[model samples]
Target: MNILCVCGNGIGTSVLLKVNVESVAADLGVDVNVTTSDAGSAKGTANMNDLVLTSAELAPELEGT
Candidate 1:
């Protein structure tokens, strides 16, 4: 699975989430690709991704997906 963790700055909170997700994947013995991206970059990017993880305020932007 491909997971994208997003935040305003795409540094602190996103990085923390990425670490936790990685630990969970390790315990489950699953192979996944995790990435961190800024909300702006994520919005502008044209590439396809499996999922978007973000705060409640940001959720609405990704609702249709």
Candidate 2:
């Protein structure tokens, strides 16, 4: 699965969440291709990814996927 962790800058919060997701996926024995992206980039990239992870306030901006 391709997962995207999106945030404002794509360097801090998104990276942190990506690490946590990686840990959980490893524990669950799930192989996932996870990436981190900023808000603006996420809209362009989300279509190619299987899942988009972000805060509730930011999620609406990424709708219609």
Output the number of the TM-score-best candidate.
2
The Cα RMSD in angstroms, rounded to one decimal, for candidate 1 relative to the true structure is: 1.9
Tell me the TM-score of each prediction against the true structure: 0.83, 0.95
TM-score of 1: 0.83
Clashes (backbone N, CA, C under 3 Å), per candidate, total 0, 0
Candidate 1 lDDT tens digits, 1-65: 89888887889888999999899999999898999987777775414677778889876665655
> Which pairs clash inside model 2?
none
Candidate 2 regions exceeding 4 Å error are: none
**Model 2 per-residue lDDT tens digits across residues 1-65:** 99999998889999999999999999999999999999989989999999999999889989986
Worst 10 residues of 1 by lDDT: 42-51
* RMSD (Å) of each candidate, 1 decimal: 1.9, 0.7
Error of 2 at 2 (Å): 0.4
